[model samples]
Target: MPSNVRHLTSAHGDASFEACVVPYLDAAYNLARWLAHDDADAQDVVQESMLRAFRYFHSFHGGDARVWLLAIVRNTFYSLRAKTASDAAHETIDEETHVLVDEQPSPEARALISVDIEALQTALENLPHPLREAIVLRELEECSYKEIAAITGQKIGTVMSRLARARERLKTELSHCSTEACRHDVR
Candidate 1:
């Protein structure tokens, strides 16, 4: 095992924390990145959350560590955002600038990757924060409703409701894209 895991296991005397919490680093980072919308902010959130979790490891009562850590991450992110509220309004990207431009694949390798996936990801990036976050957590992260609830600090029912609404909106958006593509083909 790694040194950090060894230290965590020995220092806290909690094997479960090392096993469960350490494994969730990628998921935690992904959530933070999606919420914060900046690589540095995401790293800061995850680091702070890990430190807090390590300090409070003993208080954890055998619940799912992913959900527990995610709760901490969510809280830390919102707190940081609140502290930086003055700068928030200034950093917003213009919507028109986010429109996807069809970039041709380089001459060297056109057959390896699908253009549709790139287009889909660009569309996903264009979604509003709430819908995008919901889709990332529920669909891409494969988080359960309970886990998503803990991460978002919402009730499980609310997470479920939001996920349902998000899926419907994504479906509508994708269908519209498909229709536009078909019309362009005919023309």
Candidate 2:
């Protein structure tokens, strides 16, 4: 058991990490993207977090690797955030996740997806750091409350409260957008 973390699964080394952590790259990137609020910065953070995880892989006892990796991601994001507080705080989130049009959906379908994505992105952007993380982990990453608690180093109660608050905020935000949109003229 490491001094700082709870019991992680005791296992081999790099190969074990490769097996356990590699699968969660998307989840890590998603968390990083939400935290850094920029795809390129998120990629940088994930890259750094992966390196740190590899360096500290020995300390990782063999529990849930996803939780461990995301914790490192959160920590890395905070470290970078601290270093570039002014730049990071004011950085605009660039939406670059390409929507798959391979299915050849109708133009109307694409437009609806665009609008929903825009409003959701705007709402998520407006969320404070804590609430944003909770929602992103729970809603986007599909992490259990226990897992979220572990990754965030927060009690389950705190995680649940933040999720509830975040959900309310998102609901209000989306509703306002929908109503204001009035079947068209969406932002």
Candidate 3:
């Protein structure tokens, strides 16, 4: 690479990194947080993944940047987990941490008309990492089976199966939540 060519390439790489990787920060963090099961670890994983992605930005071809970034995030999380085996065993309890206690509604008051996003998020947080990641990639990120396969390094068939199972789990969980709420109403 010539001096000017190298400089131009550096600039282009920087621009591409910003345009492609920056937008996927939330998606990356969500995936990492689910997999790592700790806010700080998740943050660290995403930051490290961003740095690694930038360092190898030249390798990226034009495609879905979210999938590419997610793959990096997934790899980074697993690598760190493997390197720190015992450390990975300590799982943090996030249920009470993220739960919001709304002011109790009076019996005569109109029933709460809307489902809380935070509650739904907390429910998602409680899902196992594999199921959670599948749901996040397929439902939240709207990634196709092929893209998810690339990101997860799984075959398309496995991706499809995981996604189907994840959806079923979520539906079952949500249904239980709804039934509980209805039971509470009857009391």
Candidate 4:
């Protein structure tokens, strides 16, 4: 056990805030990063959310801790955004310029892969905030529709509709990019 792990007496509950909440840090950060669109802003959101989660940990009953933490994260991000609405409008989300690569490819190997990471990212960023979140929660975060609904405070049907629209929009955008690329190749 790490020295930092806090153990509530078995009487209170076996679930440590560290055990349940820490496991979702990456997922929390990922969602925050996408929502906040800036690394520093995302870090702030996660930090505040963690604090809020710790404060309310005793209230959490046995259930999906990830979704619980994410709901806090999402709410924190929105609150932060609301406070900085004027400034946020002027600042571009870093996701537009940075690609999150899960795997490192050698320069030679990278040349062989023709995927336009920037285009995909731009398309994702262009989506309405709600639709963008739905896609990220479903596709990138791999949350089920029900979990997404809970985290987002949307009906399951709304989650499904947002996802459907998001996918269609992405497909249309990417297809348009492909068509433009082919036209350039022909010329």
| lDDT tens digits, residue span 19-121, model 4 | 7887888888888877877777777888888778888988999799999999999999889888875645323646434644546888655543425676787
Model 2, position 57, has a per-residue lDDT of 83
lDDT of 4 at 87: 43
Query: Higher-TM-score candidate among 1 and 2?
Result: 2
Best by lDDT: 2
Error of 1 at 126 (Å): 3.4
For model 4, the stretches where C-alpha displacement exceeds 4 angstroms are 1-15, 87-115
Where in model 1 is the C-alpha error above 4 Å? 1-16, 86-114
Model 1: lDDT equals 0.71
Runs of candidate 2 with Cα error greater than 4 angstroms are 1-13, 87-93, 98-104, 183-187
The TM-score obtained by model 4 is 0.82
Q: What is the lDDT, from 0 to 100, of the residue 70 in candidate 2? A: 96
Tens digit of per-residue lDDT, candidate 3, span 1-187: 1233224435666776777777787888878877887877887888788778877888998888898989999999889888885854435546555544556766334234235444466567677777778788887778888988999889999888888887777778778888887888854
Model 3: lowest-lDDT 10 consecutive positions: 1-10
By TM-score, the best candidate is 2
**TM-score for predicted model 1 compared with the true structure:** 0.71
Q: Which lDDT tens digits does candidate 2 get at residues 81-181?
A: 88874854535646467453545768888888888888888899899999999999998899999999999999999999999999999999999999988
> Candidate 1, which ten residues in sequence have the lowest lDDT sum?
89-98
TM-scores for all candidates: the values are: 0.71, 0.84, 0.72, 0.82
